[model samples]
Target chain A: MFPALLHDALTVGAVLFVLGLVGILTRRNLIVMFLSAELMLQGISVSLVAWSRYHGDFGGQALVVFVLTVAACEAAVALVFVLQAFSRTGRLDAAAWQSLRDAEVPRRIDRELPATDAAPPVWPQLTPAGVRPRRDETAEPEREHV
Target chain B: MIAALLPTGTTPLLAAAVASGTVSLWLLLPQAPGSDWLGHRRGALGLVLGVAALAALAWAGRRLGGLGDEAVFQIVSLVAIVGGAATVVTRSPVYSAIWFALALAGVAGVLLVLGAQFLGVATIVVYAGAILVMFLFVLMLAQPSGLAPYDRVSNEPLLAAIAGGVLLALLTTSIGRLSADPPACCTIPSRADAVATAPVGPAAADALAADPLARLGRELFGRHLLAVEAAGLLLLVALVGAIAVVSRGEVAEATRKGAS
Candidate 1:
């Protein structure tokens, strides 16, 4: 029973890890890439917990505690570095720092991108906060759009 | 009905799942110019394929592992996997962070179901409460007003999807080999076997519940004290290092401005 559960849980972790791998490989945004990396770590955490259960010991869980600590530290330090990179380059795109690549490597140029069909989001306007003015009952044209 | 449609063989089911998943991911991934005409239709097809792939994967898992597990485990694991996938695929980084928080919630549920009570709650408090908030702060500080062009186009999406599919197939194939019986060659010998005489399975769970937190504390402080100390030191170093780097960058920027 324990082994069956372990197998199932491990399968879930593998899916998550693969998703993260693809995201990190393809995504250009630095923050998105970091998020994908974190996702991979989450997958590892799940597998570790499952193994700990199977072993009937604290070993896997103990290691997971350390994993959590390392993840926290990595996030703190990595975010700072990301901020520095952003300040310097003024963009979150990883390709912005292509100069860091070896000279012989061909440059990454953006291919033509499709224009988004997504409409701009409209924020609801709030009424002015103050004393309510007395409405003239005789006013004409009660149309809401007007 | 669904069972009838799926192949009885695990290999075929797994292969179908992986192939469909790869295609789904490739379609959903943000790609360059030619994608516009395919737009809404492409998204629909990808969504359909993604659902089919998830179903196939779940079926494969069930076939590989014997059934009769708690329904709650299935539900939470599904939630975690789906949320993790969303976190990877969302175009906006802020939305990606939000999806990650949802994934953390699902993971916490999985942990709780797995009987790691402390780790379960701790995952929520540490990850969703602290680390996730920090991520959100960074995103707010750095994200542009609308979607950045970079977010709309990935690097080699097709290649990435194929690579991911291959990796997943390998991992799943390996995991599927595990059964209720640990193969004699791969039997795990652990501190539990050495220290405790209690029987495993349901009885082991009862033993675990009797004093899991206390036992876990003993394991950490008694056996792994040095490692715990090292982790503490690592955290402190990361703190100081982060602050140092940020301050140094500010100073350099100031100097550069002055020189200019």
Candidate 2:
């Protein structure tokens, strides 16, 4: 009966591991991938504890403690990196951000600046001479209000 | 009151029965309609199957002489299986985390049954206390809106079948091996007895209880003094690292403003 119980636990662990693997393979969302990674960790922990119990030993249990410590550290660092990535790129899609190529910042910045030929003329020819064009009263707000 | 129903001679039998019942209940709970794939009907079927499994395990344990190492092991294993399955099947991350904690506790129970006090305590403290809390934090941070309709994975049936088949084969082989070579002992003192006799807890109450906090004080300043100090230092380091990571951008912003 106890063997059956251990068997069932091992089975559950294996199922979780497979689910996590498939999720990592198919999911495009980074957060989902992260969640999948957690599932994998959980699966391993379950299996380790089961083995420890089967053998009547404490080593496996002690190892699980270290695994937990490492997992916490990993989650903290990964989340911070994820936040930074999201801030840098509005779109979360990995494929869309291909243009952010490494070592091409100079060319990318030059492309962003407006072309001289396409710039709007500062002084229009249709404006009356000598009398400066009346500033659009509605366009400029009352500066004194500040 | 319920304990009275279980005769002294049959205490092991009752415990075994309860353990089995809990395991099956856990297995069947996930198949409930709450999950997207296993519809209400299938979920109901799974529940029925789970109940049946629990009953079967309990009956087997009772017939084989209720008080034995094997009986205890099976009970603990049943707990771990049920908890693990619940953890995976539940959609809510918090629920899953709770299930995982239960699973860890069950594992610790197994250690205690095996007469490994230090291991059991360590498992409870580290896995249940620290790891599960971290899992909860991650789950809360990555909040998934419940509005989205549930979609079962494409190859779920195939994957499940393969995994089930493999597990069945492994179990069969292991069970065959175990049955061929039975252990020598049949009945042993329960874990509670071992704990009572152990030097750590209440047994030391008379000497240390005089100073209410003496046990902890001794641990901190005695044999484990260095380890306690190291743990404190480690926590301090982790705190500093977290602060640095969170405030990097704010510090940069402040510096830029100062320069301006």
Candidate 3:
């Protein structure tokens, strides 16, 4: 039962890791790319916990604690860099920093994009509530500011 | 003829599933080649293929090694895997972050089922509660209104999908093989059995736990003391580094302005 559980958990981890890999490789959004990196970390965490469970060793669980710590530190530092990059470039696109790429690498030029055909998001509209009060023209105008 | 073309072995079937999955992912990525053929309909087709790919993956998994019998594991793992895929493919960074949170929840559930009760809860509290919220905050700070062009297109979608899918197939296959001949060093140990019977020094025995949580605490404080201190130091450095960069960057900006 435990072995089966390990195998299944590992399979799930593999799937997640792959998804993250694909995301980081394909997506051009810096934030999304970092999110993919986090997803990979998560996959590693799950695998570690599963192995720890199977072995009954505190080693795996202990490692997970360290992973959490490291991930937190990484996020803090990396997000600062991301923010800095964004400030410099005014874009969250990872491709925006291709100037830093090796000179031998081919430059990435974007192809012309077709106009967006996606429908504008439907916003909820609230119906006007309650009746408008009638103005009383008969009332005397009392206070003008001194 | 169709039956003749079908995969006869686990490896072949897994390969087939992986190939199909790669195509699905490629199609699902923003601005995939041939995506213009269907105008706005390509996304729907990709969704269909993605689901089919998942079903095939599940089938291949059952053949590779018997999947766990627990219903909860199946549900949570499915949630995690599906959420992870969505997190990757979602065009909007905000939506991606939200999907990632759901994936984190599913991971937490998987951890709980795996019996690391503390880690499971910690995953949710630390990852979902803290880290994910941070990701959302960054997205809010950085994302331009509406969709950016980068979000509407991908970098090498076909190659990326193929690479990821092939790697996944390899990993799952390796894990499946391990199940057939699990290492003798790591036999299954129940929670109570592990706690009660773990070989320990006389001093360390006192640190041994009556409960899993206490046991974890003992391990953390007792066995891994120096590592913990180092982690703390790392956190401090990260904090200082982040602040320094932000401040120095502003100073540099001011200097550049003065020079100009």
List TM-score (chain A only) for every prediction. 0.79, 0.62, 0.82
Q: Model 3: residues >4 Å from true position, as ranges?
A: A115-117, A122-146, B1-13, B32-35, B61-68, B182-210
Give the DockQ (2 decimals) of all models: 0.58, 0.05, 0.58
Q: Provide backbone clash counts, one per model.
A: 0, 1, 0
Instruction: Give the poorly placed runs of model 2, Cα more than 4 Å off.
Output: A1-65, A78-146, B1-39, B53-74, B144-147, B150-158, B171-260
Which tens-of-lDDT digit does each residue in A19-131 have in candidate 2? Answer: 45544443334444555566566567666655655543334455555555566666666665555455445322333354765775433121121222124557846756596
- Tens-digit lDDT string for candidate 1 (B1-260): 22332234677888889999999999888765456578567777998999999888777766654333567888888889888888877888999999999999888888888888889998999999988898899989998888889998899899999999999989876665444344679766654564465455564544355778887888799889999999999999999999999999999999999999
Q: Who is ahead in TM-score, 2 or 3?
A: 3
DockQ ranking, best first: 3, 1, 2
Clashing pairs in 1: none
Candidate with more favorable, higher DockQ: 1 or 2:
1
lDDT (Cα, tens digit) per residue for candidate 3, span B87-124: 99988899999999999989999988987889889989
- Summarize candidate 3's per-residue lDDT along A10-114 as a digit string, tens digits: 888888889999999999999899889999988998999887776667788899999999999998899989999998999999899999999899999998765
Candidate structures ordered by lDDT, highest first? 1, 3, 2
Let me know the TM-score candidate 1 reaches against the reference structure. Answer: 0.87
**Which 10-residue span in candidate 1 chain B carries the lowest summed lDDT?**
B1-10
TM-score of chain B for predicted candidate 2: 0.51
